[model samples]
Target: METRKLGDSDLEVSAIGFGGWGIGGAPFWSTEGDNASVKAIRKAVDLGINFFDTAPVYGFGHSEELLGKTLKPVRDRVILASKCGLRWSREALGAISKNASRTSIEEEIEASLRRLATDRIDLYMVHWPDVHTPQQETLETLVDIQRKGKIRHIGVSNYSIDQMKEASRYGKFISLQPEYNLLSRSIEAEVVPWCLANGVGIVAYSPLASGVLTGKYDKATRFKDWRSKGVIGTFQGEAYERNIDKVERLKALADSAGRTAGQLAINWVLRQPGVATALVGVKNERQIEENVSAAGWAPAPEIDARLNEVFARE
Candidate 1:
C-alpha cells in the first residue's frame, strides 16, 4: 500500500481507501452481518488502508456508527472522512435529500461528530451540492466550522468545475470526490485538469462502476440493488448492455495482464492523473483484499493502452 498527500494539505492518506457505503446495509446495500462487517474494517486497517470515507446519510447513520466503533481504538492512526449535506428523517432511500444550508450544516456536523465519535474530523465533505442553498452560504459555514476546530479540512463530492470555483470563492476545499471509473470518465477532459492546475486532489468513488467492471455480471444478469437504475451512471438498458460489451473486452485484456477485471479497473483508476485515491467499497475482508491488490502495481504498457481504449469516453 502506498500513501499520497491530499491536495496541498499536510495529511498523507492511503491510495486505496475503505468506502463505507456497503457496510451500512439495507435500503441500498446488504451486508453479511455486524460481525463480518466489523472484521472487514479491522482487516482493512491491517492491510494498511489508512483512509476511510463515509456519509451521514449512508444507512441514515449506521455507516458512521459502525466505522466509529470499529476504528475508535486506532483513531490516531487513521484518517476519518465523512460527508454532510444529504440528510434523512427515516431510514429509507426516498427519505434522503440534499440540505447544505447554514443551519442544516451546523446541525449535520454535530450529528456526524457524535455518530463518528470523533473529537475532530480529518476530512468533512459535502456529499452533494444543494442547489437550493447558495454555495457562499455552505462554504462559509464549513469555513467557520473548520476555524472552530470541528473539521480539519473541507472538501466537496459530485461537484462540477463551475460549482467548485463558486464554492472556492467563499472557502477552500482540498479534494473533490466524484464517481470515476473505467466506465465513467467525463472528468478527464476538464475536471482533472482543473484539479491539477489548482492543486485539488481527486478521490474517485465507484472505481468498480458499481460492480459492472468486476467482469462477474453479464447482459442477462440483472441487479436488484440501487444500481438497477442510478441517477448517476449506467446500470440499465442498452447503455448498460454497451458497457457490458466493453467490459467483456476488458476481461480479456485483464487476463492478458494477469489481473482480475476488478483489479485491473481499480489499477487503471489509480494510475490516472490527479487521482489521489480510489475509494473502494468493501463488505467483507475478501472484497477489500482484491481492492488492495490493485494498488502498488502497474499494467504493462500495451495492456494499459488497451484498457484506456476499451473504456474510452464517448
Candidate 2:
C-alpha cells in the first residue's frame, strides 16, 4: 500500500486506514461478531494497511478494546490513532455529548490508553467540537499530554476551518478527519483548501458516503440499523433515489476501470488534494480486501471530469 505523511508530522500512515466505527458494535452501525472483526483487523494489517483509526465513543470503548486486542501483537508495526472529547454517562449508555474541557480531555485520554492497551498513542485527536470549551484550553491540554510522551501528535475531527485555526494557535494540528466523499463535498468549498494551504493532512471518513456510493442499494432496499431511519440525507427518500442514480453511472465508470464502485469512490477521495488517507470502515476480511484495492489508483482526467459532471447534475 502507498504511504503518506500525516500533515507535516513525522508519522507516515498507509493510504488506506482501517476505520473501527463498524467493528465497535454500535447499534447504528450494527456488527457481526468480535471474531469477525478480529479477523478483519488482522487481514487489513497483513494486506499492508498500517494505519488504524478508532475512537473511545465508538461502542463506548468497545472499538478500542477490540482494536487493542487484535493489534497489540503488531502495535509497533501500525500507527494507532484514536479520538477523545465525546463522552456518555453510565446512566444513559447510548447517549453521548461533546465534552472537551481540560478536565474531560485529561480524563478521557487515560481511559482511552487503558482501553487501547497502549502506553502512548501515535496520534490522538479531538473527536468533536465542544461549544462550551475554548479551543485554547483543549489544545493546551493536548500539548501538555504530548509533552509527557503520552501522545505523539494531535489532530481534530469534524472541526470547521475557524476551529482548526484557533486550535493551531496552541498546537500545530497534524491532521483533520472529516466526512468527505463524492456525495458529501461540503468541506471542499473551504476546509479542504485551507488544510492544503496550511499543511494539515486530511483523513477522509465515509469516502463511500456511508455505502451509498457502492451501488449496493436501490429504492426497495432498507438498512437494518438507524441508517434506515432517514436521519442522513443520502439515506432519505428523494436524495437516496438521486444518489443511487449517480452510483449507477459511477459503477459504469468503475467497470471500465476494472474496479468496484466502492473502490472507485475511495480512489476519488484519495486522489483529492490534501488527503493523506481514506479511513474505510470494514467488518470482515473481504471488505478490507475490496477497500485496499483503492489505494494508489487514480482515474483518468476525462473520467474524473465525467464524475464531476455526474455530481453536478441534479
Candidate 3:
C-alpha cells in the first residue's frame, strides 16, 4: 500500500482508508455484529489500511466503541480519525440540533476519547457546521484540544468553502471529509479547489454513492432508507436512473482495466488532487480486498477521461 501526506501535516496514511460506518451497524444497510465488524477491521489493518474514519453520531457511539475494542491492540500502529460537532444523547441518534457550543464540543471530544479507548486522536474533525454556534468558538475549542495533545491534527467535514476558510483562521486544518463521488460532485465546484489551494487534504466519504456506484441498484430496485424516502432519491427519479447508467458505463471501463466498478470509483477519487484518501465502508473481507486493490493500480488517462465525460453528462 502507498501512503500520502495529509495536507502539510506530518501524518501519512494509505491512499484508501476504511470508513467505520458500516462496521458500527446502524442507520445504514448492513448491521453486522461487533465481532464480525472487528474481524473485518483487523483484516483491513493486516492488509495495510492504516487510516480509519468514524464519528460518534454513527450508530450513536456504537461505531466508535467497536473500533476501540477491535483496533486497541494496533492503536499505535494506525491513524484513527473521528469527528465532533454533532451531539447525541443516550436516547437519540441525530445531532442535538445544529447548535455546537464550546462546552458541547469539549464534552463530545472527551466522550469520543473514552469510547475509542485512545489517549490521543490522530485527526479530530467537526462532523458538521453549527449555524447557531460561532465558528470562532468551535475553532478555538479544536485549537485547545490540539494544544493539549488530545488531538494531533484538526479537520472539518461537510463544510462549505466559506466555513472551511473561517475554521482555517483559528489554525491549520490538515483535512476535510465530505460526501463526494460520481453521484455527488457538488463539492468540486468550490470546496475542492479551496482545499487544494490551502493545502487541506480531502477525505472523500460515500465514494460509492451509498452503493449506487456498485451497479447493484436499478430502476426496479427500491431503497428502504431516509435518503430514498426523501427528495433526492424519490423526487429525482430520472436523475437517479441517469446516474445508474453512468455507473454502468464506468463499469465497462473498469472491466477493461481489470477492476470492479467499486474499485474504479475508488481509484477515480484517488486520482483527484488534494484527496489524501477515499474512506470506503466494507462488511466483509471480499469488499475490503477489492477496495484495497484500487491502490495497487492507477487508471489509464483515457479511462479517467471517460469517467469525467460520464459525470459531466449527469
Candidate maximizing lDDT: 1
Report every candidate's CA lDDT.
Answer: 0.92, 0.89, 0.83
The parts of candidate 2 lying over 4 Å away from their true place are: 90-94, 228-233
In terms of TM-score, the best-performing candidate is 1
The global Cα lDDT (0 to 1) of model 3 is 0.83
Clashes of each: 0, 0, 0
Residue 18: error of model 3 in Å?
0.8
Cα lDDT of model 3 by residue, 1-314, tens digit: 89999987999999999998877765644565676777788889989999999988777788899899888999999999999887655534333455467898888889999999999999998888898888899999889889999999998888899888787777778888988887787878788888888888899988888788887777767776435555232213787777777888988999988889988988888887678999998888778888898886778889888888888723
- Per-candidate alpha-carbon RMSD to the true structure: 0.9, 1.7, 2.0
Give the CA lDDT, 0 to 100, for residue 192 in model 3.
81
User: Model 1, range 174-222, lDDT digits (tens) per residue?
Assistant: 9999999988899999999999988799999999987889998888987
Worst lDDT window (10 residues) for model 1? 223-232
Across 114-176, the per-residue lDDT of candidate 2 in tens digits comes to 999999999999999998999999999999999999999999999999899889998877999
Candidate 2, residue 21: Cα displacement in angstroms equals: 0.4
Candidate 2 matches the true fold with a TM-score of 0.95
State how far residue 114 of model 2 sits from its true place (Å).
Answer: 0.8
